[model samples]
Target chain A: MTLLPGRIATVFGGRRWRSLAPLAVLIVLCILIAIANPNFIELRNLVRLANSAAVPLTLAMGLTFIILMGSIDLSVEGTLSVSAMVVVLLAANDSNGNDYGWWAVLAAIASGTIMGLISGLVQTTLRIPSFMATLGMWFIGLGLSVYMLGGSAIRLNDASIRDLALHRFLGLPLAVWVAIGAFLLAAVIQYYTRLGRHILAIGGDEDVTKLSGVNVTRVRITAFALAGFFFGISGVLAAAQLGQSHAVIGDGRLFAAVTAVVVGGTALTGGEGGVVNTLIGVLIVTVLANGMILLGISPYVQQTVQGLMIIAAVALSLDRVRLRIVK
Target chain B: MNETFSIRRIFEGKWTQGAIPLILLVGLLLIIEIAAPGFMTGETLALLFANTAVLFILATGVTFAILLGGIDLSIQAVASLASVMLAQLLPSLGFAAFPVAILSGLVFGILSGIVHVKLRVPSFVATLATGGVVTGLALWVSNGRAITIEEGGREKTAWINATIAGLPMVVLISAVIGIASFLALRYTRFGRQAIAVGAGEPAAWAAGINVDRTKIIAFAASGMLAAIAGVVLAARLSSGSPVLANQLLLPAIAAVIVGGTAITGGLGGVARTAVGALIISIVRIGMTFVGVNIFLENMVFGAVLIAAVAITIDRSKIAVIK
Candidate 1:
């Protein structure tokens, strides 16, 4: 039994093969859907698939770092909601006379960063677990968003900003392009920065990383901060796409983003995946949702499938031999 | 100086453990009374206990999981699922639906435990995923709508609202469960093993304690109790919906931590949870009484949760807080 577990761990433990499996699943899913419905591969459907994926992709990109370091951020939905409201109210909205355009978007992003920074501070300085801190942060964000919304939705009045969701370039919406840009930036950080490498090291083993003279606290905080920044961008894109904002706009995105990250083969225990994995994971999740609708499956079943996917993904990617205790 | 120093010493004494929540509860009551006179009426008191009973039950069940250095985020979702299932089962099963609802909780708890222990996923993530599945199940079963108990079914649960010696049955049931949980934790071998495991798993294993069994039992207890709470909620509301008990997760968690039970595990009990639940209930009702915006309620719970965890967490037990 011991030998069997270890062997399975090794097979799934290898980074190259681990990433490949998700890619293979994504391709298989696409082909199967195309076969089932010839229109699944049509440019419009594909564009729809990509459009649905953009927000989740951005959210997952931020979560990738946190998961990479073996921490979680349950505050994504909350952060997105708060930012969505912030961006809407600031950028020409029906509720307010303000029309700051791109500057409002920047302010909204800053709000997300501030929330992320506080979460980071709470996690590191207070010694609270990231889950608890972020969970608390989630409520705080929702409360703030709801307070701002004052019991109604805010419609975007800026045609230029709303066009981000309506206009398509290279057959993809501007929102999709923005998500791609965020992914590229994240990849650059992951593959070519000290912060990214240190995150991996910390996740591998915090004590060793600390003993090796790395500033573990700073790195962890930065990872969360970066995640918050991405959440901000996602909030902006989501609001832009819907052409309106409310406290509930960010709902269902957290599960989607986390699901994508895990489905892409990034270990929840940390140190085993990157944004590259998340990109594919986003596609997989999006394709699954899109295909579910195309095939006339209930959206309710989608949640069950995603929930099971997380458990199976985490179970399979788990590196048993490396840790003495599972908890 | 001598008297104050001795009082401080008494506060720090091991015998004084679990007293802080009680003290906080008293302090909050005093504030509420001052802010709104006649708030201490028997009717108002009854209302307070009624509100607290469901939360107390949830915290009681969750206390077992927390006592074992784990958490069951799925409890609230399980409770919702139980309520949804009970709503559907009540008409056909009459009063028999209660057990079936509670049993489903037990099964889910065991499944969560298995996933956490055998499958080796962390309890948080495992419970989270399971919670999501339970939520989906609830939505699917309820057709994403509230399921009202028919008039016939309502008669079956009417006893839940009946007064026993001037106390609501719901409040009495929660008290019984609370006392039972406290005794079980204090007297049972399994309870001792749970504490041992949470105190330190490796040492517990070395001591020949069935560590995995203890962990699984903790989660099972959590699930079952959450279901019981759900049943009571459905009884009170006369309906079950996918969203029933959706807002209770944070408060229940806050109740557990605020009761002086250490979030890191093995340092608290159901007695403490009872006190904690009272404190949380008062604070919630107190917020409404104070005219705080309903939207800010979640924010307050969030803040209180962070503050409570910070204060009660045993930093010594956790070398690394992930």
Candidate 2:
């Protein structure tokens, strides 16, 4: 657990070498890809990589809090779809005459927050596991969006909405900047806030956290709440970027977000790792997918590869002695 | 003394295992009768039994995994893969296609089990990963399209759509599977071992049980049943579809959990899960009968599912929920 023998970087708990492992692996992956295809290092491709990572990065950052608390949220796709549909329907769109402008953005975020609150309440008050609560909420969200949309896609045409995701600033896509800003916000929350520290403590030892005069339930609710807000924001951005919205808008993003969290050296057992690690995880996933696409790899094969990587990452990051049985 | 007494009570209370779902199912039926009086006819009951068959088969296998305190998210994916394989193999193998598809499912389940055991990875993640791979294989095999059984070949699979003595042949098949599984789980050494491992893994291992073998075998059983369900599903549709097979996964898992089998493991069986599946199908049908919004139905199902898990969960056995 020493600071790597005075190397200046505080490699916290260097005993397991986990803190540096994902980063090292990510670097190796980048180098290998760069060698295999030098075009991978090109600025245009790299920017596109960052742009793609933006939505997922926000999702991972939000989810990092929940995972830190040792709970899971499988409702991301459901909430994402609901929020996406909400924003599209509220904004100046083809499906409806209503045009709430920026207020629609607030509405979208509110929808996600509400879903998170329901998930949190179900877990804490009902004493149901987070997995099932969130899963149920996922179906609820999916059903809500599907029902509301009535099986139709709505195209958003708001200028402000387009600017939120599509506009470029400082030679970078707006989506990328939004993602970086989200990461910074999450970092501040993780390191400086009482709620964030409490989530980590609860994950580490729930009984100890409860005994120390901490409101475990409230902290958990807050974690899910913030995560929901971010999921909503990501959904809005994703829909805006695409200019079309439907119930399936966030179809496959949950796995990618979860993979980023676990691959970033965060123990699925909880209470280990931070946003910086997640950023590295997100980068690794983004780069790998981008590289595979550049190499003309088939989508089906890429799915298999990602699935394998998920297995490897989870197996490697899990602390065996601490976690004897995994359900 | 109190802890030991409670544990013994949980083990012996067969009535408690399915009591809640039974009450819920009865109440739901009554409500359905009152709301839509004509809907309780023999035809409606037949349709209910028919639709319940697929999920009942899926949940039967999931009950094994739940008894072992693990889960198999790969069930639906394995079923999907089996469907595609059955579709492709039928032209060549005809009647043998069913066994071949079932074997593929068993192999897929065993593969996931081996990974989970050897790597000590969580079954949740391991099954999910394997499910992803299976999904890919399905799309690849079917070339991402539905494969319809054509012409006279359809007649070979017609039993799937046939009715016997007023009930669909599918319902009869599920009943047979259910009866066999119920007997095996209640009377066999493997079944007892599954309960022990789920009730307390550390204690089971200490008491000289082959915990790993029991878990892996249970998972494999789950896969086999799910594959059978897929075969029947494909037959009923007269076509095999990768996507359609996946749609049944969540409902099946919900049925198993809602059936009063603890997610923490042990204390329920296939019979209980059968009740759970029946409850789900009834609720779905009853909602439609009452003119309930299908969207609201999803929300209500989610809420009810949460309540079901909350009521059935063995909190004392589990220290945390992830």
Candidate 3:
């Protein structure tokens, strides 16, 4: 009996070989794809992968907070899109000659943060489920973005703002550096802060957290606000990279970010997983996407494979004993 | 005497919950009728019924998944795949392909269920993952092209589109499915088990319910019904495009939630959801008829959904918002 218990402890301690399964698969895929095309190992490809991973990584880090609280935020895509559009509309050297400079970026971030706050308030004060509340934000954001942009893609020509994506730092783009910094900040807050512990407690057991005087509502609202900040940053980065911004930029980020969070060994049921896991998750997803493109796989097939991989990752990481019903 | 009085009160409370969506539906219709006199015309009404048919069907199917406190986000992707398959195989397999297409959807949905239950993943993630796979499959099968039925197939398409006794065939089908689902939820053991599981998983488990299996079955049923909806939609449109059903996701979920179903699981039924779908369809159609700016309309719709959920969700039961 002691031996069985010991084995279980070892497995749960994150020291066992099984904990590395997702990492192993990721490494193997990278190796196999690199072998298939030696160019995949080139510095340019690696840099490209890092750059591409930047936005999703930031978004995933934001989602990690909400997921850790055993809730979800589906509004990231809409918020990101709206922010991106705002960045382009305000700063882009368009035919209208509107050049608000760096202020545009500030405005974009503020919009995203405000949207997040509203969603958090609705969920916490109004007692709406996070899923429904965030979804409502999604529609509102999408509609508002479209209304603001008027179905036109705006080109960003502001050199200072665009430098974030185009400039290289430590042999990788500045965007990647920003993503790394964001990741570190998130990790710190998640592990070291009182709010972080409270979030985990909430996810683990809401009543228990409330009983412990955790101020559950405030913590959740803060998490969402932080999530919105990350989304705003991601939107700016996205616009910088593409040199243009449109309302549709947010279309696919939600799935990609959620996928990364899941791949990073974060439990969808929440109260577990962290920024480090999300970093790995982001790398895995970005690598998979990059590998598929490098291997010349059709975009359609890439989507299918990505979908399959998401399912497989969740299946491998999910803890069945804890959940009574999954919805 | 007290027992009888309490029973009557219980019945009345249930009716009140059921009445909200009905009232909203009538209210919207009345507003639309006043705003646009032509909105209630036979042709306009027929078109609205036809347009809502697919939504109603999909909503009904999703109601089952929602009933078990799980959501099937894969319905849109499944519908997309089913639509593509039906259209692509029509010439070779003719009408026989419809069942095959729907069956594929059911299989995919069951796969999602198995993964959710057996792997112990949350239904949200499980369905989300499967939804991605289904979307990928749809894209792959369609080769990124819309598959249109052959030119001469109009006769069959029209036949399928034709109304029975002045009711659109799609609406009639939706009605039949809704009635069947209503009965299953109200009368069957499976339905009771689902409600029990949703109400409190631990309690249901203690009561000897196979909670996982019930939830899985509910998802499977949802998938099958979504496929049926997809087939109907494909027949109506006479084409299958991989991207066509993508927009359906929000509306279907919105309809389910607005219908008084709890997002946190338990305490909703098919009848309530059907009423919810009707309300949604009318609101959307009515808004269009009134010529509300498309963008503002979306915002309003989303706001309404959130407001409805805020009003309808039972706060006492859910101790924490998350």
Candidate 4:
């Protein structure tokens, strides 16, 4: 009996260790890069790393919420792209003659939120799987963005938004602070609210949650809506960062955000992991990417490495016993 | 009473999961024929058949994976990698390297199967991981550049490009594979075991079936088929690129689903998937010929996918779609 308890303790410890594996890998990678290139330790480079990770962090936070509900949102890329394009086109000096101003930002975010809500409704009411529903949304968003932009990139001349992305305060860019704020907000909503608990319960067991009188559909729709808000904010930030917007702004964010969420110990099957894990995941990914750059790794090699990391992270985090069949 | 019972049995048999694809195919053809008078011309028909061939081949390969209740997202990546490998080895290894490249794809597929079966990871996550790795390999091997087969390579590609009595060779290959898969599923023990596993793994296991090995082989077979599709696609295109098969991922899955293959697993076969692929091809070609706006094309595709899935997915088999 003592032996069994000891073995159980060992297994528990092993799980905990695996959960922290990505963090350890990130720390080691950072140290190695610092040793290889002294410039990697510089404050400016660190800030740049933070800024680069901000968009992905925001997207990942939203994705975490969806994944926690045992659903996925593949529409993030499309929503982000469309929103980014909207921001640029509306705020473009030529397109709108610079008249939209701050309202453009608001409109851009609203567009994303609305798109999310629509996807949510389609999924909940039509009984379409979130995967397929969001995939449809992705196509719609991609098509609309392409049509609106006409394959042309729009330059943003909005001074305030530009400052928000480019200017630094408290030794960090505004985008980084925004990402941090989003992370904090996500944390609060996930832990402090009935909605968060309901979301988790839905993921744990949808039928049971419904039996408990939780408005399962409403919670799910709200989760998707929240994800859209984050995606919208991230898209606007991306436009501000580049000082331009193109349909490709959301091109690679999907994989990156999902990877971050997975790396942060979130279950893809949902009902576990949270914003704090995402924050760490975001840090690990950003640091790895920045470290690779600092170490002068080839872009192609970096892609392979990053992809491998994603696979390894997910493989490590997934609780296989819980799943009878994986689709 | 006997006659009526016999008639009902015939109706049920005829409707066995294959009706959806058949109807979709007929519907699409009718729409296209009405929309354009000469839509059935030899050239147009040939092109449509050719386009459907590769997709059909891919869907057939993916059918085995789906039959076992596991989805294979790695088909696109595997195909891409195989194509790149074929291009790289064509000069030195010539035709001899064809088998080698395909074998490499099989190896990757087996690895994916092991990862899923042994590691107990979900098929989606496992395939996603391996897909990323395969894509990375493709990118690394090709350096993101398109590789043409060169002069001598053109001869081999020509055979693939040439038609067998006015039908594309690719279509013939797809037909052969389709027939073989259909027969295998209908008669072979392997096919029955796959269906049994998908229908109820615990029951299958209790019946003393080696469920893990069956699934592994199913995935491996899927990989092999995807490789064949990739090689055929390369032969037709006359070049291999890292991104060649990126667009096929969703379409392949869509074809399988639209063919009445339950997404929850089991209860479909290769013949239905072939029809599904044909339906998708006709839709794509018809949309293009009808001058639908390119932007609206994607929306149309999505709509069609949703409609097909809604109509064909066996709701009773799926408790909840997460």
Q: Which ten residues in a row have the lowest lDDT in candidate 2 chain B?
A: B7-16
Per-residue lDDT over A1-327 for candidate 1, one digit per residue giving the tens place of the 0 to 100 score = 254444675666555666698899999999998888888999899899889889999999999999999999999999999889989999998997999999989999999988999999999997888998999999989988998898688899888888889988988899999999999999999999999899988877889999999999999999999999999999999999999998779877888898899989888888888899999999999998899889988788787888898888777777765655666
**What CAPRI class is candidate 2?**
acceptable
lDDT string for model 4 (B145-232, tens) is: 8899898887766788888898988888888989998988889888889899888787888999888888888888888888888888
The better candidate by TM-score, 1 or 3, is 1
Query: Candidate 2 on A55-134: residue-level lDDT in tens?
Result: 99988998899988878888888888888889999999998899999899899989998888888988898776788788
Tens digit of per-residue lDDT, candidate 2, span B176-255: 99999998888999888889999999998899998888888988998899899989888887788777666676788889
RMSD (CA, Å), each prediction: 2.7, 4.6, 4.2, 4.4
Better of 3 and 4 by lDDT: 3
Give chain A TM for each model in order.
0.95, 0.94, 0.92, 0.93
What's model 1's overall lDDT?
0.88
Considering summed lDDT, which 10 consecutive residues are worst modelled in model 2 chain A? A1-10
Model 1 pairs in collision: none
Which pairs of residues collide in model 4? none
Which pairs clash in the backbone of model 3?
A327-B70, A327-B124
| TM-score of each prediction | 0.95, 0.92, 0.91, 0.91
Q: Model 3 has how many clashing residue pairs?
A: 2
User: Candidate 2, A86: how far from true, in Å?
Assistant: 1.4
Best by DockQ: 1
Q: How good is model 1 by TM-score?
A: 0.95
Candidate 1 at A237: error in angstroms?
Answer: 1.3
Task: Give the best candidate by TM-score.
Answer: 1
